[model samples]
Target: MQNIQHPMFALSLIFSFILVTHAFLYFISSLFSNSNYWFYFLAQECILFISAFILPNGSPTVLIGLLPVLIAQSIIILKNKLKVILFFMLSYGLYCIAITINYGASELPIFIPIFFLILLIVIVYTISYNRQVSARERMEFYLQQLELAYQKVEELTLSNERQRMARDLHDTLAQGLAGLIMQLEAVNVHIKNGNISRSNEIIVSSMQQARETLKDARTVIDNLRTETLEYMDFHSAVLDEIKKFEEITGIDVEQEIKPIHSLSNLSMEYGIYIIRESLTNIMKHSQARKVKIKIEQKDGKIYMEVSDNGIGFSIKNIGKQTGKFGLLGLQERIRLVGGGLTIESMPGKGTKLFITVPI
Candidate 1:
């Protein structure tokens, strides 16, 4: 159907063009045979034809000049083509006869003006078309650049997510498995020493540790399944971590968190993870009796403090310990989100970690 309609439209356009051409020819014939009107009509027709060849799209100046030709044709035709054609032929023969009788003795200079007009039309049309084409090409180039920039942003986002997952695994599940493995190895050595009862107890403890390690690993994976951090409530997620910490270490835990109405998930999740990892390090290394966790908002920023009343180590000695990735990962996470983490402790005094993240 579209193909048929397209041909019909093309035919209509062709018919319109033929009608216009016929009208122009008849109007030219109606002008005077020996007067200035005949010369004027011929001159205007020359301009229109040159414009069509040069501009391709007719100019307003050219159309204005062509108007007299159109009017003369209309007067001769009287809306009937047969009569108009007979009168047109008679008028043309008379015009040629008058020209031969009046100006046959000399060469006319009329063609000079027509030649310059045509040249001007061609130059202006070529410049305008080239400029329009260049403008369109420039617009397309900018659009392609914008598309590439958006793609790069998407790729960087995916890369950051993968790095976060790796850091989480290294800090939580990987460390848990290492501890469990060490306990199992100790049990095996005890069995080789011929201490049957102690070996049995060590075996039982190692099994329990393995079970806990597997459960923690599963929790990490489950949490990762949620693409957006907003899927979990900040307070509830923090409490879950506290519960896990208490279950694993038998430490008394206390938490005080202030409500934030319009907290962004990115800031909240990162803050919670930082606090969780800090507490995990404390539980595994510090022989503390009680732990206090506090979260508060002030001046458009979230501040968290996790401190334990345990045998503390020097902050300067962090890199010296082999099991210090947890602290390093916490630092990296805080840095990723434009936040800061600070650790303060002495050899016998307790350790205190203060983290501040802007929302």
Candidate 2:
């Protein structure tokens, strides 16, 4: 206490306070702001020795404050447990040695050892608390991620179920309903023409169709269902389809499209339908030698056109064709997704489809 009152001890206190403040702040900077702290700690430790030796007379006041600050600093900045332990031990040893030399070892207070033991307890408790907090936070984060992954898997399962139901309905019930309606329609036409025998025949055929529809529906439900197709990139799938068409029909296809890697899954699905429908129609009705396909994005929308150089038919009679379902369905799908489809054709000319769909 007398040494602390001396002018030289006051100077030593100022230097030690400034150095500790800087090191502690830099150590804080490293923890909260991700900065370098080891250099500051090293420099502070060297200066700390200087300050400790300057107070040759026992100054328990400085050691009491400085020891705790060193422990706190080591805890905040040091990553290695061994280094933290060694730093505390070495600092405490130096403090005891300085105090013992200044005050005769025989005159040291009995409670001084007890005071040091309490500090060691606090340091140990602090390290244990820090590790527990870190482990708990990590466990919470892992649980959150697991919950998210479970939700995604559940969503995928529901989506798959819906797709399967849709395919079953479309393949069996839908086709049966279409045949029954067409039969009923034909029966009406025949009854008006006073042909009773033909009308009865259509009614009998309609009943047969209903039975077949039931069997098909059961077959689809009983069998193990799988995905319609494996997932593939839209552009690559389109290219494969075109190549297959060329191989089958001997018709050369001229494709002109920009990079389509950014198209959404829904957009790509519709694109596939449009391509297949347009190409099938060309193969069926158009006696064309060459066909052109183009796709691009413009005005924040997707534009697609399929054209063929062949003898085109009258658009008005398209409805009369029994297989006009494909083209009509294509148009409906495109329109439902905020898109428009236009057909251009005339007798002895080419047919072209202009389409616009939002992104």
Candidate 3:
């Protein structure tokens, strides 16, 4: 290769090469991942080698153009401070030898490049150190945020479990005790009227109810201890409720449940309770003969409609005092999982409930 001995031409060539190298570095960063930085380091090393041979007319001034390359490598390519220092020292030493061979060692002004090299090394090292510290701080901040999020999740889980326990107790133990009290009152009335056979029947039924209540309480405790209760499928669970309601009330139920995606256990639990609650209210209050229930998944939501052709009451009369685990409880359950409920009812007209829950 022919050496370009002109001073200005060589300086321009060196700078042009520097600018192109920077463009390649930017292009590579855009196209590839950080792991390929070694490519840039090797390229810089090759350019540094060629710069020595291209010392224009035996002048070392052209080597100044390489400061940006050295700065970039120090900041990005080298991870260790000692290695950066050693590499910069060796590169400057090579430049020194190139000039010394042309102008004897005594004639060269050694302090100029040496001065800039020291200054740049200090600046590059400081910048690298700051970046490392900044990165560590950012990592710690993210870790703290993650820990707080985990704690919030734990608290929410505990709250939901507490609510589940309360609902179970209200449905089984509390309601069972209330029923026993009413039955005992009936037994007292029968005994006072000298109806011995009727009193005996009431006593027997109350005993059976007490046993069932005890069994349910034990099951609740067992579930709490296990904490591994598998979720029942929503379709099957709702069907079981419908069957039980039909057997007890002899009300005709029409069900249309689409093939739904499997929902989360939490959603399934809440949904089943909502359905059961709605059915219980119907049997106790609505003197209806036919009921329709439609459940489907649409638009990233679970939609449930329960309509009864019964003597419906006014929605305005519904209040917080609508018995234990009434509409209020049902609404609370839906709200816990970011859901909405709409009730349409009128005296002597049919009642319809439109419920929606996010999946």
For this target, which candidate reaches the highest TM-score against the unseen true structure?
3
Model 1 clashing residue pairs (backbone): 26-73, 27-72, 27-73
| Preferred candidate (TM-score higher): 2 or 3 | 3
Q: State every prediction's TM-score relative to the real structure.
A: 0.44, 0.43, 0.53
Q: In order, what lDDT does every prediction score?
A: 0.65, 0.72, 0.74
Per-candidate clashes, comma-separated: 3, 0, 0
lDDT of 1 by residue, 246-348 (tens): 8988887988988755665566667667867787788778889999999988988888899988898888877677675368778888998888888889988
Residue range 128-168, candidate 3, lDDT tens digits: 77799889999999999998887678557756786788689
Candidate ranking under lDDT, highest first, comes to 3, 2, 1
Judged by whole-model lDDT over C-alpha atoms, candidate 3 comes out at: 0.74
